[model samples]
Target: MAMAFQSILPTLPCFLPASNLPDGIDAPAVARGFATLGAWSLDDFTSDAMWRDSVALTGTLRTFYSAATVSAGWTERCFARQVHAFQLNPDAARVVRPAPGLGWINIPFTFATNTPTTTCSGFVSLVRGEGGWKIWLLRTILEQFDGYPNVDEPPQQPPVPIDGAEYECVIVGCGQSGLSVAGRLQALGVSYVVVDKVSQVGESWLQRYESMKLHTPRETSHLPFGRTFTDEYPEFLSRQDLARGYQAWAEKYSINILFSTELVSGSWNGDRRRWTLHLRQNGEVRSIACTHVVMAVGAGGHEPVRPHYLGEDIFQGDILHTAQYNNPHQWRGKRAIIIGCANSAHDVAEDMVEAGLASVTMVQRSRTCVIPVEYMPTRAADTITTADRNQYSAPLALNWQLSRLHIRAQIEANPARFDALERAGFRVDRSGDVFAHVHERYGGHYLDVGNCANIVKGLIQIKSTSPNHPIRFTPSGLLFSEGSNDSHLPADVIVFATGFKQNVRDTVRQLFGEDVYDAVDDYWGIDNEGEIRGAFKPSYHGNIWFLSGTSGHSRYFSRFIALLIKAGVEGVEVPVYRGVPGKAHEVEEVGGRGRGRGHKN
Candidate 1:
């Protein structure tokens, strides 16, 4: 059915008039507009008149109402740069028509002077309407540093800190979330440092199992303003490959990262409006002070939420969390039962089967939403590809709606894949709401790469457990229920793939005190206005902020987080705009713009 539908796509009527085309557009006007873009200085962004004339007002009229807020975010990243000289080579410009009236243009440009020379080998997007050709979107990134491409390097050693030091901001992790916001701060010339307990930038990934690879494609996994991978790199990167990339990004950009350091505690100073942080560096205590603090520790804190069962002390052969599992080779020929059927559990089961385990069984406690790896952004059908989806322009609610429709169609066209899983007693949520699964629960789903095939082949067994009749530990295995008919599954080893605690606010409370924990909102969920809860925006505490998510999210929203911190440091008033309840079309400003934070690279 999908093939037949594709065959007739070219013959479908678009119903667009001839006027809504580039052929009817004024070529000279388009050229003149780009020339103006090349001539403008950094100061032009601050002028309201220039912004009004150059930018299309597509927020309330055409696309999502949040378009205005995104525009403001762009300004925060592009504003107040100390540029000695700027160059835009229009002769090298390339324009391609995406839709009837929309044009995507890429012009290689350079910013030289205030810092090391930087360049962006990309283009700006424009739309033609009654208002004429105007700048629809401008994506500027730090593509090349010092006229050379960013390259990967071995981990760089961190500098020892003074007994007491001062900085404008202090980020509390060195993973994707930490590096992302730190890179943005570096671009904005903010004084900051990234502190992590690990000794290296990508140590987090390196410590995971050897077979672990990214679910998302390489194009979507890049950090903000970081370099793209060459043909030598695979579409999906392994743990080692990603760790090398992170090390190189940090070294090339001169990101100040202090290794072997852990954040002990933080106390907010009300009168001074700064945070006094206590840190431990390789067993030595050090102190630092900063006006802004970012808990980039991640949406999942370091503390693992371990499950307890009765009689564990007697029955345990070997039990561990997924975080501690390395390779299945150690458990070769041993019976293994993995609890929780999330991504980690499925991946581990597949590994165990390949390693020739005596038996592999996954205990499912609840329903799981599953989708094939190909349905990801880079490999999806053309109608739902990354080119067709503009996360910045479209609202989250609209995106979710479109995603649901596309996913349902894809599954409908290939029913046998899921049908087989259901036949094997594996409960699958066919109506997979990927966004909700990610933002709300963070788990209860797995992107099928090779696990479903193993499950269907009977190499990996399934044991469905009910929450009402909880399972308990037996001497040799697990007891499904208390009744006489309850089944007992024997296992030589047990691996709990159960997920971590969902709320990072609790982690914040543990370090920053009880008042901060109560004052901050819940992290990592969709709020009323469709914005990510407690991220990239000011918390109720005023000076505290949080940043975490996937690489794509980190690349995009890091700028917003930095912008808020930059504004607060500079004493600028930020007015937050929110939609009116029950009035879908109505939007009003409600103190969103805070004084600190900067933009993405």
Candidate 2:
């Protein structure tokens, strides 16, 4: 395996600790093999027979060895071209056996060209077969970025932007989605600029509610190319921590960004195979052209959903969307009603109750899939000896299966949690796949921190609402139908935490024209293959891409996204493989490891 990798990557020497070698393997013979391979490059072994004897391709492992669209070992070839040098730390090498014949090997490596070296770890799973131990899965996690900056220190000089420069790619938004793509682009040596309507790097996160903190642990939230939140940061990152982290990341990478810049309009030039964009930055209109445009704006778009009630006009209270909400201190003595029951609504309700509000009520419209905060993800990188990180490399179907089993186990072990919420008049949805509720539906769930207990203890009131009878606003508050009886809930403020309901298509139409909008596919939601639709992968309109979701999604998928864009930029012909259902052989065409391309775009 080391010789195979060294064939293409001269700078990266894959080291296997002599103590950790398989039972039958001879260390001296391995040393001899490496000594003889000094004269040969990857090109010398061109035939299929060279790799056929040693390598067995299967399942998700194909992603590491080859891609359906590109040639065999395309990923490694690209990585070799991008990275300068790699130094392996043999001390960190270890292997674990979950069962007989199954072994997982982890090795830590570093990039040596930066002021502070970048650390990364690679995982490889092997199965002892009739022939010998063959690699089943190979994965890597970039644990830290090269030359990570210290945000606590006095601000350093920002990178100077080139006047009227043309970029190969123009990324919109500077949040996780945008920065993740930018990090990959920087690694690939792609000329790009990130544009945000906000004034600073972390303004998007900073503008969120002051009381907000991520429910998921800090381990699962690192940006792409391996930049992590420091040890001093909270386990669950606060809004301020995330904000400062984003700012520091941009500085660490010297990412070129234009603040207070809005894209006025955009049009694709099919003739020239590029995009022409009109951007307004600080009152000046600038026109630029690019080979690609990335809409990393986010899933919850700029438009906030504010549902209007019958008598909202006459109501003598503030009707605001959660987007306008800040700390709950202002509403300390007032009665408050929050209109949704997902993560944001739960958070707002908890805040109001904690702030000593006279009345804090959550108006739930639909059944929500609620889980204990303890069940949420912690970083897999935290454990090196365990096979925990392999879960990150699982395919969509496999992940769905694992999630279903895990949720089932959780429900069986803690039935009281769900029962308590149900008895309290909260609709706890126990059916359907949790992954679908998150990745497909986008928001039908909430990871309970303290809100579940608040609901159970009646500190936070739950009023169920339905579309059958619309809510009506009164001079004092809202009128709802409670099991065939009408109930009046008095409130001074109604916060619509109904989420960003605006369709992505509308946002696309508003930015680009109808033609471009029509050309693009519907964004978000999982497709037939269980992979996210119209994102990371190629879109209907070849040069346009959509990136959404949390930091983990961005970190994992950014590699493939960058690879696709890089192929286009370098004029490498990579075909698109659409899989056929129920036919394993036909589907394998989509997962083929062949060495040639038919057409691109």
Query: Compared with the true structure, what per-residue lDDT tens digits does model 2 show for residues 1-601?
Result: 0000001111111222122346765433332222211122333221211111000111112222211222234333223224335444444445643334434443333332121133344433333333433343344443333343321122244433445567788989898888877777776666788898999988888888888999888777777544458788988899999988888887887888879999988887777877889999879998998888888887647678666778988889888888898878887899999888889998899889889999888887777778777864344454321323455444444455456556666677888989999899898877435566667666657888888999899998887765333469999998876667778889999998877853465677788877677666677665443455566666546677778787777766665565556556766433343423223355422211122222221
Specify the highest-lDDT model's number.
Answer: 1
TM-score of each: 0.72, 0.72
lDDT of each: 0.63, 0.61
Residue range 68-158, candidate 1, lDDT tens digits: 4434443432342234344666655556453344344434445532222333322444444444444443433323234321322222333
Per-prediction backbone clash count: 22, 0
Q: Over all chains combined, what TM-score does candidate 1 have?
A: 0.72
